[model samples]
Target: MGVWGFLKTQFVVHLLIGFVFVISGLIINFLQLCTLPLWGANKQLYRRINCRLSYSLWSQLVMLLEWWSGTQCTLFTDQETVDHFGKEHVIIILNHNFEIDFLCGWTMCERFGVLGSSKVLAKKELLMVPLIGWTWYFLEIVFCKRKWEEDRDTVIQGLQNLRDYPEYMWFLLYCEGTRFTETKHKISMEVADKKGLARLKYHLLPRTRGFTTAVQCLRGTVSAVYDVTLNFRENKNPSLLGILYGKKYEADMCVRRFPLEEIPLDEKEAADWLHKLYQEKDALQERYFQEGTFPGPQILPPPPAMDSPKLPILGHPPPLTSNLVCNWYLRQRLPPLLILSFLGFMWTASFAVRRLIGVTEIERGSSYGNSEVKKRD
Candidate 1:
């Protein structure tokens, strides 16, 4: 094995990396707790603080994906979508086909400068998990139990709470409601057949209640729905473990933006619109599998990627102060420079440690479950 591959297989590296992730995450979680008192004083300020705090936690995975693994994402979308990204509230509809799909989505969010403000319609159990789950809890991510009766009021209120959100946010939803698997596909297709709906070969039939409810609750706040289809180019089986191993895979994502105004406002009509949208998503996946690319001219992801500082390591270091400037000038510039340097260094230090570390199931677990849609407790 090559030197990089050899280091990835080592254990001490993973432990130190995990220690940093777990410890720093706990610290950030505590910091989020400290922001609770500010909420009553200024709701918007509290949200702004949480958004930034959320980024420091979430970007580590993006760092691993981009810097350590060298994985890159190619976007297939019209220039209008590219132009509008990070400027408005959007609902991201993604297919749950691979473990790293969420990472890929977050990479896009980071590129667009909204990673700090990203939200999700996650299951409630996910909130109890460490790091990521805890981070989401503070970021005001809406949670569900998948039972419409029990979740209806709670889920609606959670989504409605975001209507007055002060920052641009991406609400990620996996309408498939579960990861794709051969058995699940068989069952999902069976449901589609029973309902007289067309079958989807690559994706499962969408669960529409959550989608419709979210659109209805966030009507005045959300601007558009981003219908995203993600697929690997070389039939690679992507997993968090693979990333930890420093294996790279190119993710091709085709995004189609649909304005909320055009979607049918009526519940039944809205559900029908969602179903039709999924059918189109299925066709996109079908085409991708056949041709190895999405239909539109591929739009490369926005540049100046969220790359970690290379160890020797990681940023645009501030301009040096001339000796001619006195102690006052040094006081003004030194602290911020020192702070950025320390933060950037620790950031790379942690990830370089991960380069040596290994992955556990928990380290690699999905917000949703693996291989099935069964609830996590």
Candidate 2:
């Protein structure tokens, strides 16, 4: 590696980056908190301001993943879906596997113009996290305790609150409800066996209550449900550490859009639909492992006997749209502030409380919503 490349990997440099990320995030969170007073007076205006604030904070992480780390995010869908990406409100069903998957999703959201306004059904505990979690408060994030009985009412109402949101939004749902792990996978398949649902090789059983409820609450407002399957190229599972050190990794996401009307309103049918979707997701993962791409024919060299014709390569997949994302992020203003404000004692802006494991991304190895987490419910 050259001088610049070597610098990117240094711990001191990473600490500098982390310092900027943490401090700027807190400043943005403070701004988001300031918007709370506008809630009753002008709710729409409050939401708009909070969205931008949220973007300011979240996009810092996206910056690390896109520019600072130079990660490539390749999307596989048709032009039609691409055209509609930032145009309409969508509920994104993202598979939970890699630790940085949400960062990748946010990178896409940043490119599509919805990064600030993006939403997710996060667990209740994240609300206490300093920057990201606190920002979620004003962003109107839906939080659940994972108890069906206790969460049903509150989660539905939270979803209903977004019916008239001012900006086009993308709400992400991790239906598996947690990160995938070996022990959880075994238990999830056992639950699937009992429920007679199809066993999934690469995912935990998707918990459907949250997904169906979100659809029911946001029916008229949301235009489509984006079924997204994410995997890293070469199956190299990625981490925030890789991003912190500016390591380059390629991510492939297969997105299939389903019109909102197609999802049945009846709760039972919707649950079944989510289950069926997971089955198809399983097949997609299987295909990705078998072939290096999603459910599509591979581009290959011609047979020796008939070498005249060959398939053309798609635009250099080397680092497709993320460069565009990085460029757009370049246009933003706060990142320059991140550079100038790096000299302060950053411990006050520290991500962890120093007493416990703090922040969601930091706790990727912890079983946040797994079966053990279920016992708390």
lDDT of 1 by residue, 1-377 (tens): 79877887666455444545555567779999999999899999999888877776676667778876788899999998898898899999999888788899988888887878899999787776667778888888988888789999999999999999988999999998977777678878877899998898898889999999999999999999999999987988777767867788999999999998988999999989999998999899888888888999789876533432121111212101111122333466467778677456556655644442323233443333232345321
Residue 367 local lDDT, model 2:
69
Model 2 CA deviation exceeding 4 Å by range: 296-344, 347-377
What is the number of backbone collisions in each predicted candidate, taken in the order shown? 5, 0
lDDT of 2 by residue, 1-377 (tens): 88888998776665545555565566667777777789989999888877766665566676778777788888887767777887889999999888789988987887777877889999888887666678888788998888889998899889999999988899999999888888788878888899888999998899988888899999999999999999998989887766766689988889899999999989999999999999899999999999888864222211111211111210112222334433554576666577456334444333342221223343445564465547746
Q: How many clashing pairs does model 2 include?
A: 0
TM-score of each: 0.82, 0.83
Off by over 4 Å in 1: 304-377
Clashes of 1: 5
